[model samples]
Target chain A: MGTFHDDKGELHGITVVVETTGPRTYIGRCFEETEQGIVLLDVDFHDPAEHDKTKDEYLQHAVKFGQWKKLAKFVVPNDEVAKVQRLAELAP
Target chain B: MPYDPEMVRPMREELSSAGVQELTTIEEVDASFAQSGTQLLVINSVCGCAAGGARPGVLLALKHSVQPDRATTVFAGQDLDAVNAARAKMADFPPSSPCLALFKDGEVVHFVPRHMIEGRDAQSIAFDLVEAFDKHCVAAS
Candidate 1:
């Protein structure tokens, strides 16, 4: 039987949260979705709370705030992702 | 490992100065989140989405009444090893800095990736985290 997921097809151009293996999550619109993997455009990264209290006391004492251009795209290996959640629609 | 520490120090500080811990090595990352309880992982990055959205949101979230028992960070390009190790704990999640995760008993229960960060402003993102913190990071008796 084919493992093609029809729901992925419906998410084209829609904003989504790609939750993958490592339980990592990516936010973007699906550029391509096949049985192999998924592609995203205008990617941004995410982080959750964890430990680093000691590290912060050291490194944080020194850091810079220069601006950075956002990454334009990214792709996720099929095996890495767990599921994709659709987010609220953006203003057209 | 990728960017010069001097170059990105300020951006990294934006988070640390706010009381978020920084994990620079694999071991450090491992030990930090190894504990069992509620934790918040803030993936620090130098991208626009981070500066314009994630950073501000996280700092604002800190001001809320309820918050995580612990909060920490790993820079994407600069702290590659630490970031990789931290993400590894997230179980198969793709690598994205400027990300946020909320862990319950060491398992990631809530997350805010870049897609969620890029579109919203600092206030909106903070509102989201505040809501999450209120829901999950309440102080223990």
Candidate 2:
């Protein structure tokens, strides 16, 4: 766990994924982290609802540029997180 | 012990209406856990956040080109045994309702917890699921 925070600290300016208790997923720049959870600077959120598949997956594109109609800052509780992974470490 | 079924009917319907099968008993969970295939077990909730994002996001992700072989759901605060059984399969993950459990060959591969759903948008949630499906679902390969 000690090494984990150090690794996360290095990602302060980089992108990361926060997986929370609802099993929800959020992607954004690593703003800051605490004992509770990480605060994502410009997060793009995920949920399980139905929408048009034919439409372009604009959100994925939004993630890279940090564009989305969402709350600018997301504070994730450590207790609610299942895990956190750097975007670069995840499969494309 | 179980929740008043009538009180949780709408929340159950939200996902059931979205084609998510409800898991009420531990036996059903045990059976599902034994099956081989990519399985998505969503721990459903009554929170406004879930209604706004998690549920909608998940349903959208399932619409992708590839998805889990079976998608099931357990209602938090309602189906006690089923939720517990599902969490038991999750290894050490702390219990969080409105979680997304992605399983591969009966092993918990990816899990999404409630804190993740709190303030995220539907599209963001959808993107995560699509990526998970691509990387974890055998059918996607």
Candidate 3:
């Protein structure tokens, strides 16, 4: 199996949906990756605990409509992140 | 291994200068949590967001009239034992450096993880920390 390091630069500049182990989820353009976390630019982060939309509903809407940018840049820690995928791959 | 003590001296001093006690050993961590009343525990890190936001924000928050009974900090890379002990106290929280937690009578009442720090200015961070302080901390005479 490849290490997390192997995928570091490959995702740069791609619009990806990132789900974390915590309450938040992010959809943004991957700017950089470090041992610490993935740096995302123009991110739309949603915490269902504080928002009206469920994670599934948000993902569905984002897949069809595209992400709504909220944060200009942020880091989603590697340990807290559950999954990261290309936004285009989610299209049906 | 711990970070070069000299290199991280300034980072430690930033919080220490603001009256946050440094917790460098497991014993210190245990003793601090054992105390009654509210305390603020900062898991310090060398990350840029920490330097730019968390530390400055915490300093500003402490200026509020209402404040925790005590404030303490543990360097993430330099104080391994204390950091681990602190994390054990906050088992519910996912481990993250540049994090902050408020404890009342030994229970965590509020927490600010690294994600909340990233991409924010010190003023924004201080605003949130002050909100937590107002809600959870009591004013000292």
Top of the candidates by TM-score:
3
Q: Chain B alone, TM-score of each model?
A: 0.94, 0.92, 0.97
Give the per-residue lDDT of model 2 (tens digit) for B1-141: 566788678778877887888888999999888889999999887655567778888888878888898899998888887888887887566455567878999887777665565457889888988898989876655
Query: Which residue pairs come into collision in candidate 3?
Result: none
lDDT, ranked from best to worst: 3, 2, 1
Ranking 1 against 2 by DockQ, winner: 1
Tens-digit per-residue lDDT, B18-129, candidate 1: 9999899999888887787788999888766688788888988888878788888888888788888888877545455567998888888777765567547889999888
Ranking by TM-score: 3, 1, 2
Lowest-scoring 10 consecutive residues by lDDT in candidate 3 chain A? A1-10
> lDDT for every model?
0.70, 0.71, 0.82
TM-score of 2: 0.59
Task: For residue B9, give model 1's deviation from the true position in Å.
Answer: 0.5
Distance from true location, Cα of B82 in model 1, Å: 0.7
TM-score of the A-chain for all models = 0.58, 0.66, 0.84
List-wise, what DockQ does each model earn? 0.04, 0.03, 0.07
Could you give the interface RMSD of candidate 2 in angstroms? 14.7
TM-score of each: 0.63, 0.59, 0.66
> Model 1 over residues A5-90: C-alpha lDDT tens digits?
34656655445667666734566656678777887776643433333333223112111111122457778888888877654332
| Cα displacement (Å) at residue B113, model 1 | 0.9
Candidate 1 TM-score to native? 0.63
Instruction: Give me the overall lDDT of model 1.
Output: 0.70
lDDT of 2 at B88: 86
